[model samples]
Target: MLSGQSFMMFVVLLCTCAFAFLNGFRDASNSIAVAVRNRALTPTYAVLVAAFFTFVGTMASTSFGVYLVSAVELGVPDGIPGLALLLSGLLAGGAWGLFCWWRGLPISSTHALIAALAGASGASALLGNDGVHDAWRMLAGGVLLPLLFTPLFAFAASWVLVIPVTWLVRHSTASDVNGVSRAGQAVAACAVALGNGLQDGQRTGAMLTLALVTAGAAQPGAIMLGPQLLGAGCLAAGVLFGGWRIAHTLAYRLVNIDPLRGMVAQTVSAAMLFFGAMLIHLPISTTQAVTSSIVGAGTNQRFESVTWQQVNKVLRNWLATPLVCALLGGILYLAMHPLVS
Candidate 1:
């Protein structure tokens, strides 16, 4: 017979996997949105390439994974309460992700999950758990600040990047520029997909690692390959499932992006992701970076072609994601307190 603790751990892992899948499903478009819009690659091929590169990125490094575990582990309670908290946060984050996807809005899963965890931590404090004190502080420094600025940085970088790219090709014919940019966009798409895997892959792996430590199956700071592979596989599968609604919103609704602009946006976004993962050890949203870059690049060409209403809608969702998921997580944790406590 399975022990109660083991059962709880199993439940947490199951929720984690489901959340990972939903994450991939929602974020799948981040890498390929601009590429597809510009016809750099077919929808089918774009997804396949994105999935492959994402998996590779997920397994590439653990620096960000280690940082995530440390940051979040500080806030979670010990033992069963911790497992319950994690479960609640995952459920809340995953639910919010689906809601946004259904609405065809791309919000940051990274922000949602961290905010959910912080909310669950607050609930734990209400239940007299002492580990919740630094939750918000850690979240602010680690996730919020980075997320807040990433989009702006991506926007500026992508917008600036186009100037140099265009200058180099100034002498080239329109056909030449389009042809080169199409191939460049394809490569850049894979790069962004890889960066997505690196950042998002760490979130799932860190969550699983935290659960294992809570369940006494592993030690803190010791990330295992099994969990990494599992997280990568689930994420890659989510990418394969594809989030066409969100993709369409990005590719078709947000802005009109040519091959040149698309390539620059994707490349800049991918560079930002890599920087966040490797050097800064922050979990920035691929969606925010990619979306902002696309818009920024598009604005440089024809400001009228960019859709402000759709941009406002996405921005509203971005602002709302953290608050809504936090409240939802707190509610779920309070509801689960009776059973777990």
Candidate 2:
């Protein structure tokens, strides 16, 4: 007969899957917020579109993105031996994401996943080296990029983008400019959704796969297509549902963004995320990217127009994101450790 201890470990893995579902529910705010708020699409339709892309992206990539994020970095081994770490990670990430959502503070699922992975792996390293180097690499890819470049680059990139469109209006014929701008807005918004799907969806896939590994159902080296599908499906559905409150904040409150400015910021942020997902295999936060992009574009409009208070609020939450996740994960593990063991 299977050992009782083994069965408990399986329960831990199930919890990890539960966390993946929460990630979908909590982070759904990121993709559809802009589309729904802009009146480009109804909230329901926006979420549907977002959900479809998230599902496609998460399901398509097997071993990449979320799986690697959830599994390899936290020192979780390929097989069933890694349950504690995996469950700890999912718990950490879910708590962090939920906290942010409750506060109506937009933090990146990318950031949450990275921090949770670190906490799990860091704690696990106390036992022995399973696979923490990947965590360090992830630190570079996920956190470092957002911290170093997102605000600066996103800000600058948005301005650079806006300059051309503004200039085109000035230099080109004015007769059809409004129609052209409107058309451009539609295209840009859809592109942002696509880009976010390519980037963020992969993280969902990674997390789902990690859940399977926690249960000993798969190896880190092996790909679980089922988990990927579930992750993608949840993420996309969440996006389709959309977070109306946060969307309102991002669309109107963060900065005084008109349609053209919003388009540039969204597109630039999406591009950064897409490139990171494809090339760096790094998970970047669309929340940070878009916010920074908006700040960037806003700064160009007038230094005074950019809302420093809003940015600070976001920064404070950014600082809080990892701390909360780590603390919660450790506590949850301690409380459940004996039961799991």
RMSD of each: 1.5, 3.3
Off by over 4 Å in 1: 63-66, 70-75
Best by TM-score: 1
In model 1, what lDDT does residue 83 have? Answer: 88
lDDT of 1 by residue, 1-341 (tens): 98888999999999999899998888889998878878899999988999999899888856454356442456455678888888888999999999899989999998888888888888778877754547887678756787679878988998888899989999999999999999999999999999998889987777888888888788776567888889999999999999999999999999988899999999998998888888877777899999999998988884577899999999988888888988998999999989877
Q: Score every model by TM-score.
A: 0.96, 0.85
**Model 1 misses residue 116 by how many Å?**
0.3
Could you say which candidate leads in lDDT? 1
At residue 298, give the lDDT of candidate 2.
Answer: 66
Model 1 is weakest, by summed lDDT over 10 consecutive residues, at 63-72
**Count of steric clashes across candidates, in order:** 0, 11
Candidate 2 lDDT over residue span 1-341, tens digit each: 76654664656646655655555555555555554555556666666666665666565555344323655655565433356655666677777777667767777766666666666666655545463457766666677556667767788888888888788678666446645654555565556666666666665666566656655666765446676666666666566556656666676667776556666777787788777666767666777787788777766774577667877898888877776665665565555455544
Candidate 1: deviation at residue 231, Å? 0.4
Q: What root-mean-square deviation over C-alphas does model 2 reach?
A: 3.3
Q: Candidate 2: deviation at residue 155, Å?
A: 1.4
